[model samples]
Target: MNLTLAIAIIAVAAGVIAAAMRRVPIGQVHSLYRRGQPLRLLEPGTHWVVPGLDRIGHRIDLGGQVLRFEQPQADSHELRGTVYWQVLEPERAEATIDEAPQLIRCGALAALGESPLAAGDRRDLGSRMKQALNGALRERGLMITRVELEIA
Candidate 1:
């Protein structure tokens, strides 16, 4: 009888552990899904989730981050450096569901496509990339803070 009782208690404990548990770390946000549909955004905190019902989707960083990319050119030239960006609205980032690095790279490449790079001061031209990136990213609740590039 005692062994059976101990097994019962252990089962209950496991169930409780699986049910009442969720956490979002600082400088990040997570998207919650219920019944396989997007529910809401979970900010940094301890949260409670319904086991087997509510699920966590993407964990997006809210803090500033930089992504280093190597952009290859036709003349064997490659511009390789990092781009800085920050999430203005964590909740809105859920809609895009794309990671920060991908977003930064996409925006930077798109910007470079629009304006062809020419022979000039690379520093001056690289710093101006932020202007082009913001045009694509601002609507997605992200903004390009700065662009640091090394043109090779």
Candidate 2:
């Protein structure tokens, strides 16, 4: 009975040790939460975390990304566009917003022109959308590099 108990304890210890070891890959980062609260962002490479005490909250991509979305304009026209963005601050990105892509989508929807934009109007709309998205997301740590919008 003593031998069985010792073996069980050893197995549990090994499991804890394994759970504590984590390796965050390159180009990606993760936020560690301690006791269900936000802690800190872990950069790429090996990391040690307390098992069952600390947990990874969300894995965030640190690289530049393009998101395509289609939304309706105020005039009932379909507006399609792609947003190019990169994370300027990881901690702010994690804490400031729940989802970045959705925020961009919402911004695009709000900025859509009231009329179906023409070829010449598309350029103007892109600039307008860029400014609008930046206005909404700048405080949230996401920098919008470019916005391309057209009447779909």
Candidate 3:
């Protein structure tokens, strides 16, 4: 009976230790939070975290992401294209990481809407939209690498 109890205790301890170990894959970052407050950003590696107290709030991917957006204009033409983006600073983007796609989509639509539809230059429009988006997103740790837009 005594031997069985000792083995059980050791097994339980091992399980607890395993549970506290967290492995964040490469090309990704994790935002750690404690007691509902932001703590720190965890890079790609194996980390030891307090199982219950420390929780991963966000799993931010560092790889480039594509956001496709389509907006119907008042004249029946649709502005559509793909936006290439990536997170440059995980710390700064932690707060709004989940909404990054939506933010980019909305910003693109707004820029397209404000531009003259009769311009007939998709390349120029794409470059302009890229600049406008980069201006707005840089502060949030995000960047627009390229914008491919077409009015159809």
Residue-wise C-alpha lDDT for candidate 2, range 106-136, written one tens digit per residue: 7887787456566688888888889988988
lDDT (10s digit) by residue, model 1, range 11-127:
999988867788889988888899989988888899888788889888888778878888786666777768878889877667784765676787677656534456675667666
lDDT of 3 by residue, 13-85 (tens): 9999998999999999999999999999999999999988999999999999999988887787787899999
Best by TM-score: 3
For each candidate, how many residue pairs have backbone atoms clashing (under 3 Å)? 0, 0, 0
Better model by lDDT, 2 or 3?
A: 3
**What's model 2's lDDT at 76?**
65
Task: Give the clashing pairs for model 1.
Answer: none
For candidate 3, give the lDDT of residue 79. 73
Off by over 4 Å in 2: 1-10, 72-77
Local accuracy by lDDT, each model: 0.78, 0.85, 0.91
Cα-lDDT of candidate 2: 0.85
What is the Å distance of residue 119 in model 1 from its true position? 6.9
For each candidate, give its TM-score against the true structure. Answer: 0.81, 0.84, 0.93
lDDT, residue 57, candidate 3: 96
